[model samples]
Structure formats: structure tokens, C-alpha cells
Target: MSPDSVLVRWLPVSAIAEADWPVLSALLPEDEQARAQRFHFRRDWESYTVAHALLRGTLTRLAAAAGHPVAPPDWRFSIGAHGKPEPILPEGVPPFRVNLSHTRGLAAVAVALDREVGVDVEWLDRTNLTIDLADRFFAPAECAQLVGLAPEAEKDALFAFWTLKEAYIKAVGMGLALPLGAFAYTLDPLSIAFDDRIQDDPDSWYFQRLRPTQGHVLGLALRHEAPERAMLDAAPAGLAALLRLAG
Candidate 1:
């Protein structure tokens, strides 16, 4: 795709089916197809399959839009020492980057080139947030903010903060290896900032709340060097549209 283009799409896992496998299959190189199949067996078959399909479909659409072949490119991806996925860029094709996340029934894919990006989403369940667990997983300041919230609003706000933090950590690609308790995120509903530990690399991270739904909250994270605008689309038809666009 053009260097300026940034694509983000969200797909519902429930909307995917066995019939859609062919579309996703067409996007994988022979090797990835095998690896993905194994990943399915090791995880929840339905969740893994659906997540893979959504990513494949989104990438296919992105490639098409860039006038590249709709099929998977020659690049290879391997997990970093810290468990972040990184592309083994191949020759000839334009540099391309992608990030994937799935939670509950929703899957999201973010694609661009020349910059690193990360995205994440989670289904919110207020009942799941316990003060003790929050203390263990959240920064002390975050816990204080959570405790100050009105009882009914606390769960939702806590979740929003959790999601934003997770999204930020994922964007950095260190996953849980990075200490969550070391950094504090602002309690603002739609925005978050890191504590002193991240101040040196402040521009490399950003977080934003996405459209919320019953039992769910979504978020996106990207390096400041990447495009500021992020496009989001819902499932089924959205996945199809993204594929067609890439094609």
C-alpha cells in the first residue's frame, strides 16, 4: 500500500465459518498454513481459526489496495526474544507491518509499513475486577484511581484502564515480560499516559479508547512516528470489504 495508507479492521469471531477458510487459506504461504493449523490445535480451535482468518482477510485487502498480489507476500514473521512478532522482511516487496489481537468474540488487525504498530481489545466484565487483583496487576496510582470511582462506574473505568495498558504493552511487543506495575496509566476514560519509567520513550507510545459495547472495550496503540489516524470497521461484511480492498 502507499506509505501514507493505514488500515485497521475489526472482525467478529462469531461471524466466521468453515466456508470462509478458503479466503484465509489463500492468503497464507504454504508454510504459514501449516503453522496456523497447528496453532489452532494448540489453542481454542474456533478462536485461533477465526483470528487467523480475520488477519489474513485484512492483509489480503491491504495488499490488493497497494496493487500487490492478493496472496501472502514472501516475508516471514517470527516471535522476538521477548515474544513480540516481527516480520522477516523479504526483498522486492514494499516494507509491510502488521499487528493482531483477539478477545472474547472480536478480532482486530492493524496494517501499515515503515513503522511499528500494535492493537488490542478485550470484553469487559465488571464482575471480574477485584481490588486485590487490581493491586497486584495495576500500578499503585491506578489502584488508587480505581478505588475512588463510584461503585457502578469503577468496574467499567478499571477495565478501560486495563485495556489501554495492555494495548500499550502489546504495542511495545514485550508482552507481559514488561512490568505492568512499573508504569502508571492516567485514569482518563479515552486517553492514558505512562509513568516515569516510560518517559524517555514517551513519543513511541499512545493509547485511545475505541467504540465500547456491552461487555467489551477496545483500544489501539501505535508509535508516534506512524500515521495518527486509525480506521476501524466491524465484522463479517467489514472483513470481506477489507479483503476486497486489498485485492
Candidate 2:
């Protein structure tokens, strides 16, 4: 992978063999393991556990591929002020940025050599996604667009707008401090329009949308100094297979 490219890896939680769960879960740190145990339901536990483990595996492989050679359990991270995770590296290792998202059945991680990157994935059949919810969380123009979408297409459109907005906030590292309605996105050409609240240049950012699976929508946001478009190296498969392929 080139330094300028973004590597994305996703896992279908159900596809992971039952016996492999312990192997993957062991890759997580104590804090992550404790958090996973806090979940009340089995499915939530599985999603939380797999998402974090996949992130560790992805970063470990990425760092080693760059010749730094960190083990999956050895990578360290510190959360930024607004809650985005930042990798902590040794002096000679090149810096990289990462963001991750997980939905009901899937988990995804995105890594960029030296650029801010964010990723989000949503299971398409999310319930109660209505125009009212869009109006409450989306920009004015975005709400209007949702209102105009056909009933059959409305849910998908809402999820698209949602993932893009989420990717932007995660990339900016501001979390909810960057209001959802403060930024708007148009799907046709996948461009963004920012309101007064956000202090950003639309041109410096790049966005990509993907259907990692027929039931999921994924969005990626990246910030680059040059006009060169980002190269995406995405592996939409099980984590165990991805680890071998990336190696």
C-alpha cells in the first residue's frame, strides 16, 4: 500500500467461526475486554468485541507492512479531546491516522499513512429512520432532499446521509461538538456543503461511499493537502483471512 492510500478492512461478525472468537477477543486490551463484558446482550458483545479486535489486527498489519512491526496487542492509542482515537508510536515510526465504525452485523477500520481519516458503516435495515428524524439531525437542505425521496428509497438515502455526516465528524475529531446539521452532503457527486459553524475547506476533503455488503452502507472521509485523489485498498471479508492477505 502506498503512503497516500487508505486501507479499509471489514468483518462480518456472523461469518467468523465460533472457535476463532476467543483468538480475536484475546487481541483486545484489558480495557476493551472489560467494556465488551459490560454489554448486556450477546449480539452487542459480539459486535463490540469484533469491531475493536479487527481495529487492532488492521493497525498491527499496517504498521508491520510499513516495516515498524508492532504486534496486534502491542499497539497503543490515546483518545483526542473530542474522543477520536490517536495512535501512539515510537520516534522513528511514521504517523498514521485511523477511524472505525461498526453496525449490527459488520465492523470496519480505515487507516491512512499521514492524513486524517474517518470511516462509518451502517446496516441498511435500521429501524425508525423517518423524515422527522432526518429533519432533527440533518441540515435543512438535506432534510428537504429526504422529504422528496421516494418511500422505497428514503431509508437508503437517510443512511447514506447519516454515514457521510458521521464520517466527517469522526475525521474532524470533534464528535458531536461538530453539529450534524452544520454540514450537508449531496449524494449525486458525493460533495459536501458546510454551514457557518464548521471552519473547514470543502475542497481539501475527500469522501467515498461503499456497499461493503448488500445490507450495509459504508462511508470514508479523508483530508489531503494535494488534489490527488486517494487510493482505496479495501478488504471486505473476514478478519482472519484479511490478516493473512495483508501480511
Candidate 3:
């Protein structure tokens, strides 16, 4: 892995067999396991389980790669002022920032060294993606760009704009307190413009959109690292393999 790379990883929830779920769930801390159990549907439970397990596994690998050597179960997390979960590392270890998102059948995580990073993945067939929703949540210019686009293309652009904005807010760690309309994004070249209400430099951030699978779209945002590009790990090892595999 290059020092300048942002490692992006995703795993399909369905890939983990029912029998293997307990093994993967075992990797999670007790609190996370309790949260997973709170989901009303088993599918949601599995998604949350795989997502956080993926996060811990990836963090273990990244921390060790940086010479800190923290085990998956031993890693601790603290929530930010908003609700973003942040890793707690030992003193003298360089700062490692991470963010993860999971939706329906997919889970994704992004990790960066000494830089803030946020990632979002959404299932493509969401029924709520509509112009009215865009008008309500997106910047005026962003919503305007969606107009006149073909139906399929419009959905693609909507998710692109949505995930990018989501990535930005998550990276900021302010959650919904930061209005989505305060900053606008443009496609083709992919850039952002901010309104007076928000204080951020567009140049200090980097954004990328990718289709990790045919059914999912992923967005990545990192701060203070313009030239740093995200590199997706092909896939996480199988659920059973995940436990025995060394970071």
C-alpha cells in the first residue's frame, strides 16, 4: 500500500453464509453485537454485523501496517461531537482517521493516515430517489443539474450528488447539523462550491464516486489530501477466512 493511498473496502452481506455469521459477529465488541441484535429484521442485523466487523478488521490491518499492532477485538472507539465513531489509538501512534457506511446488502469502509475520511455506499434501487427529494435536500444548482437528464441518468446523478454530499458531511463529523444545501457539487469533473453559511475550502478536500458492485454506488471524501486517491481492496476475505486471517 502506498503512503498516499486511501484504502476503500466493501463486502456484500449476502456473501457471508448463515452458518458463518456467528463467526463474523464474534469479531465485534459486545456493545456492537447488542446493537446488531436490536435490528428488527435479520437482514438488517446481518448488514450491521458485517459492516462493523469489516471496519474492525480493516482497522486492525491499517494500525498494524503503521506499526501500532492493535488487535481487532481490542480496538476502542469514541463518538465525535456529532455521532461519527472514531478510533482510539495509543499515544505516539500517528493519527488514523476512518469512516464506514452500510446499506441494505452492502457495507463499505474508508481509512486514511493523519487525514479525515468518510465513505458512503447505497443500494442502487432505492425507491425514494426523486426530484422532489432532491429539491428538498440538495443545493438549488445541484437539483437544477438533475433536470433534463434522462430518467436513468438522472438517478445516477442524484446518487452521485447525494453520496458526495453525504461523504462530505460525514467527514466533517457534524452529521445533519451541517445543512446539505450549504455546499453544492458539480459532476463531469466533480467539484464543490460553498455558500457563506459554511466555512470550508473546496481545494483542501478530495471526492470520488465508484460503483463497487452493479447494485451499489460508493462515495469517498478525504480532507487535507487533494492528490490522495482512493484504492479499493478487491474484496474482503470470506467471512470464515476473515477471523483467522492476520491483519
lDDT per residue as tens, model 1, 148-240: 678768776677667777777777777888778867777554445456666535544545666534556776666654335543333333656
Q: Rate the local accuracy (lDDT) of all candidates.
A: 0.62, 0.83, 0.82
Ranking by lDDT: 2, 3, 1
Position 159, candidate 2: lDDT: 84
Instruction: Please identify which of the two predictions, 2 or 3, would achieve the higher TM-score against the true structure.
Output: 2
Candidate 1 accuracy as TM-score: 0.77
TM-score each candidate: 0.77, 0.93, 0.92
Model 3, span 1-247: residue lDDT tens: 4545677888888787677787788788888899989999988998888888888888776667778777677779899988898888887555778899999899988887767788898999888978889999899999889989999999999999989989999998988899999999999788899999998888878788889889999998888645545444435435554666332
Tens digit per residue, CA lDDT, model 2, 1-247: 6766888888888788887777777888878889899999988899988888888877776667778877666778999998899789865567878898899999999988888999999998888766788878899888877776688788778888888888989998988888899889998888899888877888888888899998999999999765366788887755654445223
Candidate 1 vs 3: which has more lDDT? 3
Query: Judged by lDDT relative to the true structure, which candidate is superior, 1 or 2?
Result: 2
Leading candidate by TM-score: 2
* Model 3 lDDT, full chain set: 0.82
Task: Give stretches of model 1 more than 4 Å off.
Answer: 1-6, 21-43, 73-75, 126-128, 189-199, 225-237, 241-247
Error of 1 at 3 (Å): 5.3
lDDT of 1 at 229: 54
Model 3, clash count? Answer: 0
